[model samples]
Structure formats: structure tokens, C-alpha cells
Target: MTSAEAVPFRFFSLQVVRTRRLGPSLVRITFAGPELRDFRSDGLDQSLSLFLPHPGQDEPMVPIELGEDWWRGWMELPEDVRAVMRSYTLRELRRDADGATTEIDIDFVLHGVEPDAAVPAGPASRWAAQASAGDRVRLIGPSAADNRSIRFRPPEDTDLVLIWADETAVPAASAILESLPPGTRAVAWLEAHHAEEAQKLSVAADADLVWLVSDDGAPAAIDAVRAAQLPDAERPYVWIAGESGRMKELRRHFVNERGVDRRRVTFVGYWRQGLTEEQLREQGE
Candidate 1:
């Protein structure tokens, strides 16, 4: 929760307080710690680096004592002893009466956890699936309210908001929807595996939501978005997140096909197909 003057990010020692099943593929875990009182974030899509322990370990092993050198120190540790780090979006944060953050929620996608899964669940997914009260973990997150890690930034002149997200980015997309000012115009397309995954989203903005469920044999993302007529907007902001391949495809559709300005489009590759997070990092993707 504390950071050096030069660094806006720091390590937080947290323990799981509870978990709720959001859907067949999503779980929401709430974490809290005394240090969390220092957590500050104004961004709806705040990014966090979570460190998790291996099975049988009591807590994640991160070299936080090294301070600014923590990353290098952690990288030098034995692979089996070092923590498993994964990126996630902060779904929500609660504040005390004094405006100090008290607790935070992170929604996890429980991919490949079913018995009939094609790929096995990775360390982070496995950990989240089994997380419970008192399960210890570490996080490297912003200590400042406004930092670069928060990516959902729409220009002040934006008149329309366009969003598309896959299951991995649903938590962030949902948060953005909830944060929009009243009467703001927004359109969002969310992709899910089953109808049960289409949770009710609350928003003050005048939004049109399209849920594409694979189980229901919904049209492909490009085709659906291409066929629809968007509301008239002079300055539109596009935000997209999901698998790397699909994200790129959508970006092209908006910029090249729809004639949206590339500068107004914000796209993030939350994950990639057929690649583990570790592998993606190793390849410097």
C-alpha cells in the first residue's frame, strides 16, 4: 500500500475475505487488508498485477523488501519459489467514511476448469477457482488515484461511447458502464459462453447492450457490429478488449471499415488464444 516517492505503484499484502459465483465462468473475490486503506484509484478500468502462491504455500513469495528493486529480485528467485503473477482489472473498490479504500473486488474468469475442458487451468485460474476466506495473496497496484495503469479514458468532447469485450474483459467493461455520467450515450457488445453469463448491468447512461452468447449461436462479432447502424455521433470513443486476435480484428473494423479515427479507439489484448500468460510474456507480446 505504501510506495516510494518516485514510484506510484507498491505491493499490497491482502487476504481473501469472501467469494461469489457470478456465473458458470466468473467468480468475484473480495480482498481486504489494513494496508488497503492507502489504495487510491479514479479509473474505472484500473489494472493490477496479482501475485499468487503455489499450492501448499501459505502466501505469495514476492521480494517486496527490495522496494524499487523488487521486480529484479523476484525475477531472480527460483521458479518454484517465486509467486505466479497475473494481470487483472479492479471491478470495484469500497471506501470508508473518510474516503479511504477498505476493500476491493476482482472478477476472475474460471477458464478451463470444467471436466470437459480442452486446456488445463493455469495457476492463477486454479487459485481463483479455489480461493476462500483467509487465502493470502499479494498485489502490485497504483498508490495514486490517477495513474497510467487506468486505460479507459474518453476525451471530454466525446459524444458517443462504443465498447466490445469478451469474457475476460467483462468485469472492466461493466465497471466502465456503471461509471458513465447520466444521459451519456453508449453502445456495448459483450461476448459470453452461455446465456447464464449475461449478468444484469446497471448504468446511468443511455446505453444499448448487445450480448453475444456462443451457446446460443450468436453471429460473429464483426458481422453483428457491421450490420448494425450506430447512433449519430460527431465524436465517438471506441474501447475494446478481449483475445488478442479478436481485438485486432475489431480494431480494424472500426478504423478501416467504419472510418473511425484510430486515435479515438482504445483496444487492449487481455489474453491471446492458444497462449498462456507466461508464454505471452516470454515472447514479449
Candidate 2:
């Protein structure tokens, strides 16, 4: 069946409602806006564009008009003319009692340590760390995928659902689990650099949660997840996200080795090692 065209893009002014540390390295920022009243909730796992103001800049740069043709023109513009655009997951959408206000959350992974830490620093991490309540940010998105679809309601008899991700995708993965049916049985594999970096997630009673820490070496968490055994065949749906290479590897295992139906499994490369968010976008193109 043919898919529907994307919803027209609209710019919205979002205020930072709250911020909290989810784990040692993960920070959650909740934003609310009046424009979100009509926001479509179908794109739970889909990405949105965040136009943040450059340091010291008073206003964020956003396109005056938005549409397919507008996006095409923006893409065709000189490289220098395009503003910095960051990709983030929809995470969760919550509407107020009156439905006039909506809250959307996004998680950012802290990159570096103060004077005594190891990992490198992340740009988004820094921005999130300093953002305060009432701070305004420009949001432009809810872009629909060309032929993407997901089934939230699995068969009643299905025995298991599997989810996996690293820090960058924890927000999206967690949101997905939270929206699942009350009694759905599932297993989640979350990878983190340190034990403390794993967030205490709220999942269904029937779900199994596994946290894997990467103490050393490259892609250690992915290795741990790969080495583990999946649940007994009960037609479980799998979702995996994280480092580009690791996600690609797991996608292969799910599709080629296990023969899972493509439609039942979702895989996303939230980020790649040694590359900035901008670099990842260019690579994706």
C-alpha cells in the first residue's frame, strides 16, 4: 500500500519545562509548547529537527517557510547558508488536561568529565547541561517517513519483545516500552559506559531489563549484547539502536541469522563513534 505524504512543517516555540539527570551520563530535557496541541503522536520513534541558537546568539535560525519544496531548496542552498540542525527523537508526548499544552522530552548524553574523567565532551550535552526552565528553543519537525510503519499492538499470544540501545537512544527506546500494552512481555538490553550510567527504567512486570556496561575497549556493550541468547521463539519484535557499526551488526544478526521479519524489527544508528552529530548526518546522506 502507498504511504501518505508527510504533514506540513510548522515552527514552534518551545520552553524548557524541566531538566533532570537520568543516569551518570544521560540528561533529560522536557520541553512544552502550545503548538504541540495538534502534534501527531504517531511518530513516537521518529526524529525531529532542533534548531538551537549558536552560542551568544539571541535567536535560533529557522526557515521562514517549510514544506517539501522548501526543504528541497534548503538542501540545495550553499552549504554555508544552511543553519546547524540537530536530530533528536520524539521520545514521549504528553498533553495537559486542557490539551492546550504538550511536553516532549529528549535525552542528551554527557561527553566529558570536569577535571577528572575519561570520555570526550558532547556539544548537545553542554547545551543541555546549561539550559534552564523557561529557556526557549525553536523546534521544526514531525517529519514522516516515506514508507515506515510500526505495530504497537502485537498479537495477544506473542511471548516476547526485545529492545536494545546505548545512551543516545535510551530516550526513544524507553518511550517505546512505556507505550506498550500493560501485559506485554519483553526484554531490554541497555548498554552504557559505566554501571552508574544505566538509568532505572520503569517497564512492564512481564518485561526483563538487562543493563550492560562497557568497562573497556570499543563497542564492548554491543559485544556483550551480541554474546547473549535471545528468548525462546515466541515471535518477539526486536528494536536496536546505538553506535552505527554496532547497530548495523545487530541488524544483520536479526535479519540474516535469525530471519526476523523486517517489519517487526526496528534498528537505528543514533550516533557513531568519533563523529559529531553533523558528521553523522552527512554520512547518512
Candidate 3:
């Protein structure tokens, strides 16, 4: 909110195209927009902010302006006046050259069945749930660095690709798997709350899929991925994401014990445990 020169971010007005259940815990929402005319074709794992109105509010209140002044006003507003905002990943981006329309897709993980369950259903999810083709929602971000599509090309003679993720990161992990070149050797480990929530992903022919369920409350997926043996290769890349604590642990292990080059590995903390979107931002400060 604190306007630091208004970083020149582009805004998009998106309308929900469709929403479908991906798994027991994940839902996929597709959005189309006109501002996407020149939208960059960034593939999976990209992140953005979906701004929402305050609870019980039906419409978004755009600031007469954005930046420092807006942030100051936001801070001074009553607790209920502050709206909720959530971070989500771009699971897919499709642009129609002829139609001149672009569609962006994202997956949301349903946390629980509580009355507050509606909260994690962020602004985007909320809109996706009730919005029709013409209804609009505001979208901001896809940071400059993250705006581009992530293309992972394993070395021709590499041994294998290692992917580790939890429910929050499954969509990106699945995309990464599907993008690998044919005959690429890869191993993916995904963790979810229930076995029913595990997804059947589209991956390269040589990639092996490993699914782990939290039946006994054990963090088996992370442990399995971390404990696996890696074959020596010229250069291998590792991609890991999920809960903040788990991600941090994997990062330290790869950097210290494994001696893997930091540049060759992409580790991200999709979300932290027990922290709201606002708390997460505040803690970053």
C-alpha cells in the first residue's frame, strides 16, 4: 500500500470463464480479459495479487489514486474497511491470436469446511464462484521477474529432475512436469491431506510420479523427496515449493549438505503456516 513511486504495475479486468473441481482440495478457475491483448505468455508457477472488497461488500472500491497516499489511507482505515487480498499462481496462460483474447487459469486449494472456509476462497475464488461471463474482477502483479514463463530444460545427459511440492504448489509442479522435453528423466513428489486429493498429472514419459497422503499426520512427501538419492550428472536442477517452513528446510539442505548450486535450484515458500495474507506481508517487512 505504501506507494513507493507506484512501480508501474499493469491492471487487468478479468471475467470468470469457468470453474471446475480439480481435486478434492483444489479448484481451477479460468479468467478472460481484454487487457490481455498484449499479455505476456507466462506459463505455470507465476504469481499475482487479486484485490478484493471488504467482507459483505459486493463491489471493489478503487482508490481515486494508488500509492503512498493510498497506503496511508489504507492503514488509517477501520479494520473492517480494509479489504482482503490473496496471492495465487498462474497455472496456465492461453492467448488466442485470432480472437485476440487471453485466458489465465489458476488453482485454489480449499483449506477446510468451516464457515470461515469462505475466507481462503480469496477475492478471485469468490468471484469465480458467483461471477458470470461479463462480471469483472481486478488483478494486479505477476512481478517483472516472475512475469515471464518458466522454461525448465534439463541437460541432455542429465540424470534426473527432482520436483517437491505440497498441495499449495501442486498446480505448478504439474505444469513443470508436463513441460519437460520427451525422454527427460524426472521424479515428482507431491503431498496432500487425503489420498483422494492426489491428482493424476500430465508429465513426461520418463518422469516417475510419487504421491503421498498425510494419513498418519506424517510429513512423508517432504521427507521422501529430501532423502532420495540423486545420481551424479553434469548439471541438475531442483524445484521445491510449499509450506514456508518446509521450503526453508529444503533450501538449507540443498545449499549446505547437498552442495547443490543455488542458481540451479528454485525454492519458494508459497505460504507460511498460521499466517494470513496481511500477516505474511507484514512479516516480510
RMSD of 3: 4.5
- Give each model a TM-score: 0.94, 0.79, 0.79
Which digits, one per residue and each the tens of the lDDT, describe model 3 over residues 56-78?
Answer: 66644545266436546655667
Top-TM-score structure, candidate number: 1
lDDT of 1 by residue, 1-285 (tens): 234335678888999999999888889999999989878899898888899999999999998888778878988999888999988999999999999889999999888898899989888889999999999999988888999888899999999999998888988999999999898999999988878889898889999999999899999988888988999998999999988998899999999988899999999987798886667777875
The residue-by-residue lDDT of candidate 2 on 1-285, one tens digit each, is 112233544566678899987666667899887666655546546567776655564555555465445456556655544544666776677766875437888877776834565765555555677777977777765434321423233445566777887867777777777766677777787777767666666665477777767763435655666676776774777788778888778877777877777767767776677887667766762
Candidate 3 lDDT (Cα, whole model)?
0.66
Query: Which residues of candidate 2, in runs, are more than 4 Å off?
Result: 1-8, 66-83, 98-101, 116-120, 143-158, 215-219, 274-276, 279-285
| Top model number, lDDT | 1
Model 3 regions more than 4 Å off: 1-8, 62-64, 67-76, 98-101, 114-135, 142-159, 215-218
C-alpha RMSD of each candidate structure in angstroms: 1.8, 4.5, 4.5
Candidate lDDT (C-alpha), each: 0.90, 0.67, 0.66
Residue 250, candidate 3: how far off, in angstroms? 1.1
TM-score of 2: 0.79
